[model samples]
Target: MSFTLAIVGRPNVGKSTLFNRLVGKRLALVDDQPGVTRDLREGDARLGDLRFTVIDTAGLEEVTDESLQGRMRRLTERAVDMADICLFLVDARTGITPTDEMFAEILRKRADHVILGANKAEGRAGESGVLDAYALGLGEPLRLSAEHGEGMDELYHILRPVADEFSERAEADAPETDLDVSDDAPEDFTPSAKRPLQVAVIGRPNAGKSTLINTILGEDRLLTGPEAGITRDAISVSLNWLGTPTRIFDTAGMRKKARVTDKLEKLSVSDGLRAVRFAEVVVVLLDAAIPFEQQDLRIADFAETEGRAVVVAVNKWDLEEDKQDKLKALRTGFEKLLPQLRGAPLVTVSAITGKGLDRLHDAVLRAHEVWNRRISTARLNQWLGAMVEAHPPPAPGGKRIKLRYATQAKTRPPGFVFMCSHPEDLPASYTRYLVNGLRDHFDMPGTPIRVFMRSQNDKNPFKGRKKAPPSKLRKHLQGRKAD
Candidate 1:
């Protein structure tokens, strides 16, 4: 269910007013001030049968600096990234400002998933702005007056198909229960209490990697401080982390490859990479002040690329002055940048104060569980049927890529095997769609999903398609020979 909608426009375009109408409540603060909404506010919105999450973000501005307007602009961009669709509103009363044209260009270049709307188009006065909207090349803008709720039916009509598409995905995720999945595919993983879940914590230097591990362990076992790159080896610590037996590895600070001239630092970084490869779950910790730096994205992407379950933790969150805005920005940034870890858990924590430690612990456990999850072959094939029906395999070069069956080959970073015709001809996009489907259906969020396609090796000529029946004369000849 990925039907998220973000209402974005210039100040007083009636975004918050329309947000109030959709949610059927005055949830957001409405003021004459342009930047009344500095923080992104989300509420359950309804339009006809479609129920979705609608984000009311700060108005879009031309500024691109450290000023309040600039920050709001950046946050709005992130909120747009977080949404599946954006309802780009423009003031019809003003009749399309030059800023509106600029914003339209930006939305076109960056966010193609936009539904244009001309707010305050309740009568002939709004008709001019509505026609002017056509020049924006964002399709016919929905004429509306958010103040009086004039064009909600049109809004519902536009949102209905989006709602149905997401509904189809939700239906694919929830299958019939009468499916007996025991013998078709054996369970890939069986949880063992004796075995400790292998977890590795990796990040840039001075990101509180050591301190975070110590906080989880409930002791200052590893070294911590202001100094960068203190730990030189991949240190392993055994502890019952919140009733779950876990063997956590405290990895050294992974500096950028260009800066790694020191021989010891190279060895330390290499050792940390090894920890990530061996670990079942990887926690990419980031210093809240400098979260999602180039190195941080690389580290997080590395873990995911290595097929390990990943959890992103924003450390030192206690230092943030405005928690709500920062969190909204951080999560939006997370989804925007690390899309491979789209549904992965992101926890904000303070290692020094032990704040959000419980949330971190819970996220780790949930990640591990998802990592080792196994789906039966019977259910998998059923899911495959639904997925192919919902989004058929792409036919390239006038030949169809037929996906025959699906089975779980391995778990602990769950991998699936698909028996299909012309496996090599399958497009990467379709494969990604199925992987995403598996994640959405089986509740395996943020864990790396692997799909391997193999050609069907059936030897029988009539293996799949029906063979024509033998003639009666041929049958009589065979009977005579037998007599």
Candidate 2:
């Protein structure tokens, strides 16, 4: 059971700054503008021996009305409530403002435990403001500057205890169950033998999805241009990235149905959708100026609905006037609009300039890792047992659904084969329950997840030896008769 920690504070206080630092990647959108962050983003956080789930929440806004701002605020509060520990950040450079205090009071009321962090506390200038953070009544503020990589040791100190406490509770509360899956375990469990993670780079016309692919390959392999929809076919390229061989699909740009009047464009769009279906990881690229269109959200939702891992790449980040603010705004928009990929990856880069390419690859790998993740049969069956105990599989025709066992059948898309009494009779909702369980038990959120139900007695059709050919059998019979 991974522990969850949420970072909450007023806008532009470097909440995302801290999140990127902890996750060891520029996953969250960061900018200098206020209210840029709109949605809550979660990442697998590692600090020394501390491994926990960290959520980067939108900056707290004081809006109570039923407007868009108010809805955004409500969503941020929900994120804080979901967290096991909230890292409440205050700007040491800006001092404790009214909004900071308001957010603190809100977290104190909602979060079970709050860890105070006075961000931007690097030089002598931030000293006075760090002192002001104590007035929030949260405890001694942990002084650190997220942008400069300052005071990380202090963060570890704060995180270790919470992680340990949660780990202990989870262990103690774990239920014992008798569901078994040893018979279905794969003969080869080697990571090398697992299929390469399938990744799709998709975006609107001229969003530079092809450029990014070419850059990743370090060659002029993928066709690129300023024109829209040049690539008609979804091209797959297999390569090794940091020792991990990944199969990347460069897809056609997805355009709106009304705008897609040409037959070629329609075929291209269908090809892109097919790539999405086959992919385990999907990277949605955006032109920095025209980010977050309805079509982009639709493509992202398609990936989420299919259980594929998703990442957002803001192409042409170098050309943007307010780079930081734009990235933050993009992330906020994604979280608010697409909750299906709640904790998806968002990376800023310039495909032409090659800025942030390394970070992009790192993000893809992390997303792939989550996409390929599989939990041990023991853990999954244990979780399944608890889930069944809480709400037993619903019975149709007065016969209860009997799930005999569960085992991971394949990797790339993180597929599972569940042995049941009657696979065809299992309801769609029951399968969803198991899929949700797999997502929760394993730290695989926002990745495409797959579940396949199979009958217990199902066997391979190609097993037994073949008899002799008719002509050979006839000759053998003739010889036997002669003898």
Candidate 3:
């Protein structure tokens, strides 16, 4: 029964700050730079006893064309149409400008219940702007300092009646039912709903990360154009993707570290890296015409090193002339360049035309399945014996190494620990041999496989110690008679 409120305004008007305040979490990235938010982000919000849904949208722009700013403006206008109420934010220090007036007029035409808010109106410097907000004919403006947590009481008061009205309407419209004094449950709540799968899309600049996300969403939800690095903040959107609940993050294109000098770009890259860390499946998007650049390899390698399930998606595939030949070349190059990711799915997709999306979805799911693949101890031991017999462990310095046992220590980018003699002396080449053996034998291709070597001697608590003298056990035995 709670109403949905949308915060809409021009760039850098503190809308995201107010949204963070309302949600009581730093879900949206905030910066001094304008146009930080590029998509619609929704959060469950609470103000005192009133609970509702709040949406933080991209900043309103004046352009109405096909440019990026125009697209952003259209998206913001869409939010106005969708929300039950609109909180129009204006920069009080800057005073009511032509953009604020335009936004007000738009809200007057579209929004059902509009609440004018003069943000950053804490000191006397913004007092004139707060007064000017009233002249827009939107009634009294709620003076707010979203960052400083001022005027929230006024915001709550203004929204309380609207919430109550929604509650009453919902109650009146509901069918009568038997009531129990202790029974408190939502009528439409489903307890078995699974958590959404986390997927992050990353690549170099202009690799169609945003376009792919938009195609999947089947709408112009994200601000996308020909611009490189159009996306920042690593915005995440939720959807039921082909019967699977998924939370997919759209990240800013990450360039080489040497090229990332700007402070904002550094933050954006950091955010993208964070998204990759939390993501279960990372889609390394690439340009079809220029696939597998050094940067692309690094991005995919980062995901692999982080133990994330990886899917290499070559975007703009629709532009390719010879599809079959190009696909063969791509596969050949993938195998030759990235032996660690052998057998991992490399799906060709067109973010614009939505070509081969279904195949990409299947590939992603398959990679995740392999990432979480687990083997029984008996099976692992059997496989280890065969692998050792096929290629015996090398002897070093006249000492032979013995492979005692192998067991999977973790799933989700499956990690295994091997108990053996002289594990420290084992060469990394042998480890790679075992890892590749495991991938081919267990059918766990493409996903990163972690192998850890542990020595049987390592289990001893007195390791690396000279015992400091005779053991206390020996002393006690000496003291004891012939017991």
By lDDT rank, best first, the candidates go: 3, 1, 2
Model 2 lDDT tens row, 1-483: 678888888888898788889999765556565665554556778888888888776667788876546655776788777778888888898899998888888777888999998888888989999899889899999989899988888888877777788889989999998988475776542234257767798888889987887787786555455566656666677777557677788777888889899665676678678888887678889888888889888877777777777888889888888776776788788779876676667889988888898888788878877876666888778877788888777788988778877888777568888888777888887777777777776777667677888877647675565874679888999999999
State TM-scores per candidate: 0.56, 0.46, 0.88
**Candidate 3 global lDDT:** 0.89
Off by over 4 Å in 3: 168-193, 457-483
Question: Model 1: per-residue lDDT, tens digit, 73-188?
Answer: 88788878778899999998899898999988988877748999999998788888889899999998898889998989998898888788878989999867886646565543
Off by over 4 Å in 1: 1-193, 458-483
Please report the TM-score between candidate 1 and the true structure.
Answer: 0.56
Per-candidate alpha-carbon RMSD to the true structure: 24.8, 21.4, 5.5
The TM-score measured for candidate 2 stands at 0.46
Point out the higher-scoring one by lDDT: 1 or 3: 3
Give the TM-score ranking, best first: 3, 1, 2
- In candidate 3 the C-alpha lDDT for residue 413 amounts to 77
After superposition, the stretches of candidate 2 with alpha carbons farther than 4 Å from their true spots are 1-198, 219-223, 236-247, 274-280, 304-308, 321-325, 388-410, 416-434, 451-483
Which candidate comes out best when scored by TM-score? 3
